[model samples]
Target: MLKIEGLSKTFGKGTLNEKKIFSNFNFNVDNGDFITIIGSNGAGKSSLFNAIFGTFLPDEGRIYLDNKDITYVPSHVRAKDIGYLFQDPRVGTAPNMTIEENLFLAAGEGGWFSIGQKKKSNEFKEKLSLLNMNLENNLKKPVGLLSGGQRQALTLLMATYSKPKLLLLDEHTAALDPETAKKVLDLTNKVVKEEHLTCLMITHSMESALSHGNRIIMMNDGQIIYDAKGKEKEEQTVQGLLNLFKTKEGNLMASDRMLLEV
Candidate 1:
């Protein structure tokens, strides 16, 4: 469903601070695939998502979604086809907007007149009720008033409300407390499974990577070092992944946060 070919990206190209992220990277994601990606800092995971989402175009290569080339598409235009959830709950939401208003915008239906329509509003409540966050009754409250976990849950609902062709989750639960993070993760899995979303998630926790998703990929220096799926992914353990990286990608340092999580 998604393909990247000959992708290359560099920051401050040809300057003293020039840094290369991706280099001739090529990968394919099948329809209905849920991929969990794990790597240390500066591994190009976020850059890959940005390149696909058109936050910035890759210096080389083409990105195709459902066989349509979207490499040069503007981010706002791509936003319709691709849903992205950032690590920061505040990033994707309008802090001052009421929850109802935010959902109205995310639904992308009629104008302001449609906001309070009973039919659409009921649908919103049904969706919100699934989060079990007591948000359904507080639709008029500003999103800024919600907790971190609640805001992230709302963002997840917004991102998937349209059932976009692809979803990119960038360490979306990393900011929440452990209990809250797990709750959000459970909610995320529910949304992705129910929607049958083709998703790629970047995570620092090895346990989460192994437990979630149909497939797992290990990335380093903009390269995919390992890819596992099905029985292989199920058989893997968190420590095993760490050992593999240590033995196979010698001298590469996983972030302290990653190590601690394991």
Candidate 2:
């Protein structure tokens, strides 16, 4: 349901600090297609999401969602159909607000997820209980008091409160503990399957990239070097992906591949 064509971007152009982040990077996702993106730092993975979300304008490119020209739609309007979860959970919520208040914002003012129409009562509490988290007992508590895992879980719920057409997860589990990260990842898989949400997640975990999404895109030097799906992807290994990256660029760094928690 989303399409990116010839998306390109650069930082510090026209000077010694000039760097080209994207060079005709193109990608697309069908409805209900959970695509996982993998690449090293500065692979233009996050930049691609920003361009698609309208947070940054591509120097020259176009993005379309379900055939509509969203290249210049601006972030607020784009938020109606897209959800973004950054590496930091704090980026998604108002830390000073109580859990209840934060969720109220997620329910939105008049948007699809808005809770303004309903009195903030037992109903919201009931929904929070479904998370199987004790959050239901602490609606009045400031979110800052919660652990990183709890915050990230709540953030995931808030992101999907309105059921956006596309979900962008930028290293959402990178900051959590191994156990917590697995928990969040499990919740993520559940949410995507249950909602049939079209998602694009950038992860350093090779196992996660292969095992979770229906398709995987491997990017290098701003271009998609590898793309595979279903049965083809089931045969992949972390070392295999590393070898491919090395074969293309002749080396792989310790920073590129994730350590298997097992």
Candidate 3:
């Protein structure tokens, strides 16, 4: 459903600290595809998401969603069709707002007039109950008062409330504890499948990359070193992926965080 052609981006151009992120990059994401992306530091994984979501205009290339070019679309405009979840749970939510208020905004009903409406409140409670986090009874509690996992779960629900065409998850569970992360990931899978949404997730865990998505892509130096799906992806193992990276890049991945976390 998304196509990126001849994409390129660079930062600090023409200066001593210049860095080139992408050069003539091309990628295509099929509809309903859940793609897991893994790469070392400076591999442009998050940059790819930023480019697609219009966080910054690419120096060159065209980005198309559903056959319509959106290369120059402003980030705010793209926000209507794209849902992005950051690693930090605090990034997308209003800390001081009550849980109900936040959901009220995400649901896009109207304004404060729509906040306590019985019908809308009931719907929000029903959705919250599905989270099984006892959040339905905490509607009046400030989001900042919730635990990290709880806040992240709430953010996930808010992002998907309107069903965007694509969801971008940038190491969304990287900040949580193991058990909490698992819970969040399980909820993520459930939501994506039930909504039939296309998704791209950047993760540090090799096991997560292999197990969670239908397709797995390994990137390095701003290029896709490996792309596998279906039977090929299912057959890949963590050790095999490490060997492939060593063969292609002449060494194991250089990121300490990636190595340690996986």
- Per-residue lDDT tens digits for candidate 3, residues 1-262, read 9999999988899999899999999999999999999988878899999999998889999999999999999999999899999999888889999999999888876775754578888899999999988999999999999999999999999999999999999999999999999999999999999999999999989888888879999988899999999999999998888888888878774563473365
Q: Against the unseen true structure, what C-alpha lDDT does each candidate score? A: 0.91, 0.85, 0.91
CA displacement after TM-score superposition, residue 164 of candidate 2 (Å): 0.3
| Candidate 3 to truth, TM | 0.97
Candidate closer to the true structure by TM-score (higher is better), 2 or 3: 3
Q: Give me the runs in candidate 1 sitting further than 4 Å from their true place.
A: 252-254, 257-262
- Candidate 3 Cα outliers beyond 4 Å, as residue runs: 253-262
Task: Give residue 99's lDDT in candidate 2 (0 to 100).
Answer: 90
Q: How close is candidate 2 to the true structure, as a TM-score?
A: 0.92
List candidate 2 segments past 4 Å from native.
Answer: 110-120, 257-262
- For 67-169, candidate 2 gives per-residue lDDT tens digits of 9989889899999899999988778888888898888788774442355435554666877776766888999899998888889889999999889999999
Q: For model 1, what is the C-alpha lDDT against the true structure? A: 0.91
Tens digit of lDDT per residue, candidate 1, span 1-262? 9999999999999999999999999999999999999988888899989999998888999999999999888999999999999999998889999998899999986675754578888889999999999999999999999999999999999999999999999999999999999999999888899999999999889999998999999988899999999999999998788787888767546353564482
Instruction: Pick out the ten consecutive residues of candidate 2 with the lowest summed lDDT.
Output: 109-118
